[model samples]
Target: MIGVDTNVLVRYLAQDDEAQSPVASKIIDGFTPDAPGFISQVALVETVWVLTRSYKMTRDAVADTIETLLRARELVVEGAESGYLALASYRATKADFSDALIAHGGRLAGCRETVTFDKGAASAAGMRLLGAD
Candidate 1:
């Protein structure tokens, strides 16, 4: 499987860049389930950040888009089981997608709980608060 970058997904999803969108679309369109494009965890997180922070997409929209990507026949998301767990956490709480992913990955690696300083992560993403009582 060929690895895809976040830029390619952004270009395709945004369709904002005149020159690159078509190129990105062409590459994505060429993908098949038998030889699908691979999206790594890093790219997935970056894509969510860009779609939300940079493009001003709503959190719900970003969640929907990510869920759609995870289900795409022409794409393969790395660590898909953990990714889905993160997605579920994202839906059920106000945690950031990246934070949810971190917690999920930690769980998969046999961590009892992830520790973090971020309040949202600690409260919403199942991480233990690292400071204060």
Candidate 2:
């Protein structure tokens, strides 16, 4: 499988770059289930961050985009099961996608609970609040 990076994904999804979008589309379109484009966890997180923070896409839109990627036959996202778990959490709560991913990754790795100082992460991502009473 060929590795796909955040910029390529962003370009494809955003379609904002005049010169790069078509190139990104061509690369992504060439993938198939037999030889899929591989999206790493870091790339996925960064893509979401850019889509949300940079592009100003709404939460629902970001969720929809992630869902599409998860279901795409031409793509193989790393830690897909964990990604689904995180996606569900992200949809239901106001947690950052990265925070939800961290919580889910911890759970899959047999962590009893993830500890976090961020109150939003602790509350929304199912992490245990550090030093909470």
Can you give the lDDT of residue 26 in candidate 2?
A: 97
Tens digit per residue, CA lDDT, model 2, 1-133: 8999999999999999999999999999999999999999999999999999999999999999999999999999999999999999999999999999999999999999999989999999999988857
Q: Clashes per prediction?
A: 0, 0
Would you estimate the TM-scores of all the predictions?
A: 0.95, 0.96
RMSD of each: 1.4, 1.4
Using lDDT as the measure, which candidate wins? Answer: 2
Q: Judge candidate 1 against the unseen true structure and give its global Cα lDDT, from 0 to 1.
A: 0.93
lDDT of each: 0.93, 0.95
| TM-score between model 2 and native | 0.96
Residue 133, candidate 2: Cα error in Å is 12
Tens-digit lDDT string for candidate 1 (1-133)? 8899999999999999999999999999899999899999999999999998999998889999999999999999999888999998888899899999999999999999899989889999989988767
